[model samples]
Target: MSRSLSIIWLFGLISGFNIMITGNTLNYWLAKENIALQTIGLLSLITLPYSINFLFAPIFDSLRIKYLDKIFGHRLSWICLTSIALVFFVYILSFLNPFDNLLLFASISLIISFFSSMQDTILSAFRTEIVNKESLGFASGIYIFGYRFGMLIANSGAIYLSIYLTFNEIYKIFAILIFVYLILLIVGVKYFNSFNVIEEKTYSSHTSSSHLHLSLYHSNTSLCHSRTSLCHSRGGGNPVNNINFIKRYYNHLGKSLSSYILKIFLDSRLRGNDIGKSENDLSLLSFIVLILIFLILYRLPDNFINVMINPFLLHLNYDAFEIASVGKFWGVMGAIVGGLIGGFIMKKKNILDSILLFGIIHALAHILFIILKIYGKNSTLLFITIGAESITGGMTMTAYIAFISSLCQGKFRATQYSFFSSMMGISRSIFPIISGYIVVNFGWQNFFLFTTIITIPSLLVLLKIKNKLQQ
Candidate 1:
């Protein structure tokens, strides 16, 4: 790997870790502060700005800062700026007590979400630019592992720290960590000397060619010199060449888009023929439904239990430290193991089979949570449940990620992946909010049952897509 690519990976780790901590730990803290359950639901709304990032993605794609691109390259400059912003925002959150000023905390959280979204967009684009297609999966895995580790520290370590210190103190420690990360980022920026600068002469030469082509195609005498001059001014001299290049580029782009659209329509027809050819073979659709049902059922138990974990802990007389410890250590560890295993499975088996296996494991994992809920006061049960749940959840997530990765076509990877990820986020955002309400109204046991029921549809969908999923 190039030095610049290595530096970017390092930054990815730091940023991922920080984000995981903030995302996972904040819920526990808020619950401790006596925030209303409804308000907790509203926390999901903070991600609203993230959807907006997709709209402005094109702007980032087109524009680059002239001097900054020279200094740190386009993507790195964005990363550096966003990282600094993130550090400052995280630090500021340490000072405000959410219990005292809920609005202020909410506002801060929104700002953090916005910048984080921007950071995510730029970082993803940068990763694609720096890393080759083959290495991308491994890179994503490493980044996720680092992120999960950060969550463990924030969730478990922060909670443990809170046992001895005040929340303010815990926040201060986290702030210091962010500052250290920022310093390291600055150092990386200085060390990685791989900035790509576009030459002015190249830009001019391309422009001149474009203008000359346009002048020849059109017979209007008045349009010739004026159009050429305008192109020269914008293109910085070689207007004719620039115009031709742009015309050819657009023509190619149009053809590519047309082909892509045709492919989308044709894929179904091809799949249909394949199905007919293999009539004796079990249809992919059936397998997909089976897997989808399994996925829905697997998550159902947690969906129910997750809603009540805070309340149950409080009822059982567990302290913040214990909650944090379980989440950080067990949760983080499970996630890493799960992700790694999922990646390995993808490498070994088809995506559909891997997902099916994940579904089976996921459903079994929920049984542990059921045991914990039934034996609420047993520390042993809690420990077992925590470990089991974390591992299962991690594995399930990893399988899903791998499945999504396999689905992407190389040309439209970013746009398609972004859309798929957003759907995942939508499910996450909506489910938690609904789960919270269900827990409040139906109680934890009933909520678990409800979760089980909801999962059936997801499983059915998965089963329907089984064959395509394998591809």
Candidate 2:
């Protein structure tokens, strides 16, 4: 990856750490003000906006202002807008005591949360779109490394600060980091601008509206369902009839599909372009679908249990420091080690193989969490299990993110990667919402066992697309 790209991916530092900020700062501030525990329970709902950011992702893709693009560049304009909003609103939060007016505080918190989430969503796509293919593994490693580091910084620093600093003082310091984020962002833009990212040319033809300004070259392409081939008939030829539908359909049906629906996405990745083979791109339709599937199912089992980890630890009567030692402190160290290892491995092998190997490891590591249920009372065993699982999970996730970066194309990466990453957020919310009932009905042992099973289909999916990805 270019230095610019690598620096840009560091936004994961802020994104990953935001979780710690929200959970810690909110709790500390509320307790200081003597707010009801019940009010705190309601405040947790402010985070819901993060889960559903995807519903609004399409707006970024479809809407554009020519004037803004001229000044800040295409994606940068939106990034700047959201970052400004995030800083402004978060700084505002440092002033209001939720104890004084819970509703308004919650509303402002939600607004800040929305901007933070949007910043993450936009950055995920921006990083994917601009990053070089040869650097996908390296870039992903940098991201994972930075993100894990950020987690440690947030958890360790914020928690420590609460002992000395007031809630407003602590938050103001966090708000200042956004300015640092903006500075790093500007530096990245400077480096990125040195290269030719988007190539524009003038033409007599107009799209949508007439102006001296012409948009980036985009043309209508089709899924070509019947043919199962991405035929480039841009600007002139028909999507449906240009290809020999009979021949295409027969050829498509000739292959034995492991899963027709899933395989289509892979097939398109092997063939799509701007109506032609430019950089050997995948069709937007296929890229979107592949990301969606991977996002929703790839780590569904992990996320399902991840949401309940704190409660599980608490149920076992572990202290916050103990949890932090195993999870945040040592966990970050493990993740950093894993990310570097994953990067080196990806250098030696194809991204697909790296993904396949680590993906399985990630799934199998869940068994360690189940072991926690059985040995619920042993801190020594807890230390070992949590350490082992956290390390393995970190290794696998770095590789998994490399896989996600590989799927994104620069053309509509903002929309596509946002959609993919958004589904990941949504699944965290969806599975956890029902998790209480699952644990109550089945008990922790059975619930964890089912979590292991939910992972199987994702592995099966990886198997189905193996050949297509090899293309």
Candidate 3:
């Protein structure tokens, strides 16, 4: 692989591994410790930062970290700092006993998640900014390959290692590995810089009107219409003047409220921030909201299944090594294969089509879990089910990365990508809170069925925006 490709792959691997340790890997450990299912479900809350990191994504895009920026550049500086901090916390997390000091354990886990989210936010922006348009697909495929590989090690490898090592020991070993990557990041700063093609641009106050402006305008117009009708109902004199006054008053109020909300979650300079720009700008804001909603819904099945899978496997009487070997190792192999398939399909098809195809397959893959439930600890069936699920999961995830990367604008690349990604994280971080309860109450088969059915909404949303995405 080329140097740039290698860096992209390594960052993806590190990020994928880091995210999993706090998620599925940790869930497995908790299950093994005999923790209550509800409590384990609540653990997803610790990752809240992942879902909301967009609130601060603009800072990474527009602000500079003093000395670190001088040495590592704006994006890399944040990446390095967050990596170091995440590794440090992971190492410390290893020393805590969840049974005795649950609060401390949870607190440290939250901190680890915060830094991990920060690292991921900046790294995604860096990845998006570094590669040119022509190479993005190949680069995205490589990164997904690396990411799945890292998740494989974290999920299956960590479990397999637990045969001879304590969870504490495993965490420390992983921390050391992450720290090694950090050292390489510092050493290779110049190499990465060589591939940095994006120029630093000054922020401008002028807003570009597009679809977002249309959405804002429509939003205000709707409000004014509602108020204008209320004025007519009052049967006041000078009806035309009253209607005009209501429109003016409500439009200003709506714009002020919309602007405040945008300033909080988006860069003030977004194309639709200023009201009355153009119909296109309103449409742009509405499109952004639509995309964000689509992103949140797209991965629902996968996220719902993830939190319970390891625990479910253990309940099937599969040993840690067996589960790790099949679920983690071969599963990752399947994902890598799926990534290749996704890339090939992308070359032949539009991105939305690829996403829809993979999404259908992704939802269908959950049915294998139902079959596994019926088979009852049959190792061969377990292998087949996990391999199939991982393949579909990989394809859908790769398409998702490509879809979002295509949407990022240059100057706001980091903030916009982060917003999209953070919305995606909502599925990963929040929806799983109910996963454990569902399994506990409805049983695994029903839980799997529910997950499969829930995927319909995302597909429906995808279809609703099909023309917009195609355009």
TM-score of each: 0.72, 0.60, 0.73
Question: Which ten residues in a row are the worst by lDDT in model 1?
Answer: 209-218
Error of 3 at 164 (Å): 0.5
Residue pairs in steric clash, candidate 2? none
RMSD per model, one decimal: 11.8, 10.8, 11.9
Error of 3 at 445 (Å): 1.4
Best candidate (score: lDDT) = 3
The Cα local distance difference test for each model comes to: 0.56, 0.58, 0.70
Query: Per-prediction count of colliding residue pairs?
Result: 31, 0, 19
Model 2 TM: 0.60
Cα lDDT of model 3 by residue, 144-255, tens digit: 7788778887878899999999899999988898888887766655654574334233112211111110000011211111000000111122345445545553453356
Give Cα distance to truth, residue 455, candidate 1, Å: 2.0
Higher-scoring candidate on TM-score, 1 or 3:
3
Per-residue alpha-carbon lDDT of candidate 2 for residues 374-436, written as tens digits (9 for 90 to 100): 877677877776766666676777656655544444333333344455577666545445555
CA lDDT, candidate 1, residue 89 = 78
lDDT of 3 at 99: 78
lDDT of candidate 3 at residue 191, scale 0 to 100: 59
